[model samples]
Target: MASATRAGHRWLKWVGFLCVLCAIAFAVVWYARNANGNEPALNTVAVSRGDIQNLVSATGVLEPSNYVDVGAQVSGQLELIHVRVGQPVSTGDLLAEIDPTVYVAKVDATRAQLKNQQAQLADRKAQLRLAEIQFQRQQNLWREDATTRESLQTSEASLASARAQLAMLEAQIEQTSSTLRAEEANLGYARIYAPMDGTVVSIEARQGQTLNASQTAPLLMRIANLSTMRVRAQVSEADVGKLQAGMRVYFTTLGDAEHKLYGELQYIEPTPEVTNNVVLYNALFTVDNQEGRLLPQMTAQVFFIQEEALDVLRVPVSAVARNQVKVLDAKGQPQIRAIETGISNRVYVEVRSGLNEGDQVVLANRDPRAGQGESRAAFRGMLR
Candidate 1:
């Protein structure tokens, strides 16, 4: 019985030893699997350096390069309107006409007065000729003792009076002629004509409208050249300093936000406009309108191309690590790097320094899927 009990104890000890060995083998395999955790699931981008440019944006209005205010020089009832609004006209094209009857009557009356003065002058000259002949005959009679001293004096007085009368009439003729010419000029002013070669943008006077030119010329209409347009952009004081002539610009009108037009900066006003205590500078640009699509006073959104870059390495601004970037070192281990940045359009920042061509820059990591058992195992190993 003692021998049998000793054999059972030895068998129990062997079984316990086998169980411990199995546990040790399982732990070795588990550790080996855990040690090879899945690589970090990260998004990366290649870094490269290249040129970049900056820009500033603003808003403005479109206007004509040249505009004119067509006005009435004479006050009268508008008898007729020869042109309609937006009609193209050339210089000397009759735009409108005031009733010329009154002016014409005045001219006729002044001309009649001038003719009357001329007739009186002619009559006076005839009388002078008769008086001169009598004076010469009287002088001959006095020399021959056939006339008295009183007769000779009377003839001389008549001659002098006739000469004085002729002088007065001639002076009257000159004065009346001047008045007639002035009246004729006033009559001519009744016809209104275009002063420039452009389109009639507006018509302030309609048929039968009375114009008052006693004080102001009474703006009858406005004319503008639409072939070329100007964009007068009021830039903020902050961005105005960077604006210069010859810069590239583009703008879109307020109409449906539909079309975009390109132009070059032509001028920048040296003085700033102050309204309600706010200061703004005026920047002007020119755009061709061969299509005639642009109109006056159209609000425009403007962009000034201050700088630009083409075909360069770029990355999302969010991918750039704050204060550092971790990159693989020469030994293939992660190393922290300092970098300098350049122009950013708020979406991407130009990496100007501390990176190389085709270098991988780490971005954000996404969450693993629910069924990613291998990934979970890797994650657990990393935590351990």
Candidate 2:
């Protein structure tokens, strides 16, 4: 009975050992399958014709190409606003009106003062004429010995004084006339008119609001020509040197992949803006926005084209190692080929002088013996 029990116990131990081995084999097989699936099999690829472009990317903002701020030239109470935000206006169209009561009163007072000065000037002229006549008569009487020399001298002094008084009155009248003209201009300024044909984009002053334009012209509203848009792109200093005026550039709005707005680089600002220890420069360009789809302050993704090749033979960058590519010859044998490359954007490279199209380029060695060895090594690593 003890010998039979020992045999059964040994049999049960073998079964348990076999189960453990099966579990380990299952896990190893699963791990090997997953490892193969996770990695890319860049074994070989055919040289194909495609488009390649080297571009410099930057972020930008959209704004109206032509915009103006309409401000109050004369300070007064804003009595009426004829235009609202987003309203279309023409040149010379009434935009807003300030209280014209004070300006009108000033103009009337200046006119009255100017008229009074003018009357005084006329009276002075009459008095001068009379004095001249008296002086002439006195000179004749003195020459004839009919009047005293003292009387002739007094007449001459009166004539001189009258001329001086007339001259002073004329100057005062000229000054008053100038004041009248200024007051008239101020009164006209109370009625604000659009300087250009555009749409009113903003309003800073509301009706019945008091505006003080003593130091600076108070902004009443803003007008913009939305038919055209300007783009201001901020490019890093490192990339700014690569750009130039008249370079072909394009941009798109966020999530707008269908439309591409193209324009030539117009200018690059000389001053650099430093932010977060990084220097950036602004690049400006304009595009037609007649449809009014582009708005002010919209963010854009800008791309400046540096180089481009269309319908050219290209290959993945990984396929070429050490400036040499492994190509499969007619005999199905791997051979090293020298290749001349062109513009590249890090993903694909333009093939300038390379093997013919449809030529198979080897990315990785796929020899059966080598593959078996690699698989064995990967399996052992997983087990460890």
Candidate 3:
């Protein structure tokens, strides 16, 4: 009975081992058949002829094309402000007025002095005429031997002295007239006038404020033309070389959420600005604002349109492998071809010398059969 029991136990153990082996083989075969069956192939787009533009983006500010600071030319208390901030003014429009009482008085005094000198000059002219007549009569008498030589000499000397006095009086009148003109000019400066046609943007001088013009002219107000504005964009020194005058550009202001302004490049600064270890060059362009939407100092988002290709062959940048594009040859076989690329904004690299429109370029592996699943798994593992 013991021998029979031992044989049965050994046999049951062998049977159990064989069943585990069969189960392992079945699992291996199942995994081999289903491992990569459920993934889709890559999606590709055909290269087509279309317009491609290379652009550089930057930020800038909108400023007036021309702005001038209206300043006080004469010193006095500000009595009146004829224009308010944002008021449109024409050239010679009254901007402000300084207290002109003192200047007017100075002008009056100078005019009185001038008038007095003029009256004196008239009297001198009369004296000169009388002296000329006397001298002529004395000369006639002397010629006729009726007057003594000494008397004739005395008359000539008197005439010469009167002429000298009259000339001196005339010089004094001229000096007084110059002084009067200067005083009048000063009086005119007391009333400030707009130097250009623009809108008042700033008012630094207040009513009753005293301005001192002994040194620099004190700022009174600022006038700017808002109908047209300029955008001063800073392009990096590296990219500035690509920008040139007359190139087209577009910009959007932060305030104008939906509108974009287009313009041509106007100017480029030869010098670069170095700030915080970065160098940038200034680029300028003008935008028309007939709608009166743009304001001075408003931030603008700028784009420099460097190059544009129209109706040209273009493919996704990723479609190019190793700077070489892979496409199906005439025989429907995979082949690689070298291509020359043009300006790229890093998103779409333009194919300049290779491939034509309607050619198919293979994009990166989206194909499930191309071992992408394993690649993705490896990538995920690396991330962890």
Q: Give the whole-model CA lDDT for all candidates, comma-separated.
A: 0.82, 0.89, 0.85
TM-score (C-alpha, index-matched) for candidate 3: 0.79
* Candidate 3 residue lDDT tens string, 1-384: 999999999999899888767766775675566675533433557777776788888778999998899999899899999989999999999989999999999999988888888888888889888888988999999999999999888888989999899889888888888888888998999988999998999999899999899999999999998989999999997888888899999998776657878999999989988999899889999999877788998999998888887766788888887779888677655578899987655657778878887787778765545664686577557434
**Residue 144 C-alpha lDDT in model 2:** 94
lDDT of 2 at 7: 100
lDDT of 3: 0.85
In candidate 1, what residue range of length 10 has the lowest lDDT sum? 363-372
TM-score of each: 0.68, 0.80, 0.79
Query: What residue runs in model 2 are displaced by over 4 Å at the alpha carbon?
Result: 1-46, 322-337, 355-371, 374-384
Looking at model 3, the pairs that clash are 41-367, 42-366, 42-367
Scanning candidate 2 in windows of ten residues, the lowest lDDT window is: 364-373
lDDT of 3 at 250: 92
Scored by lDDT, model 1 comes in at: 0.82
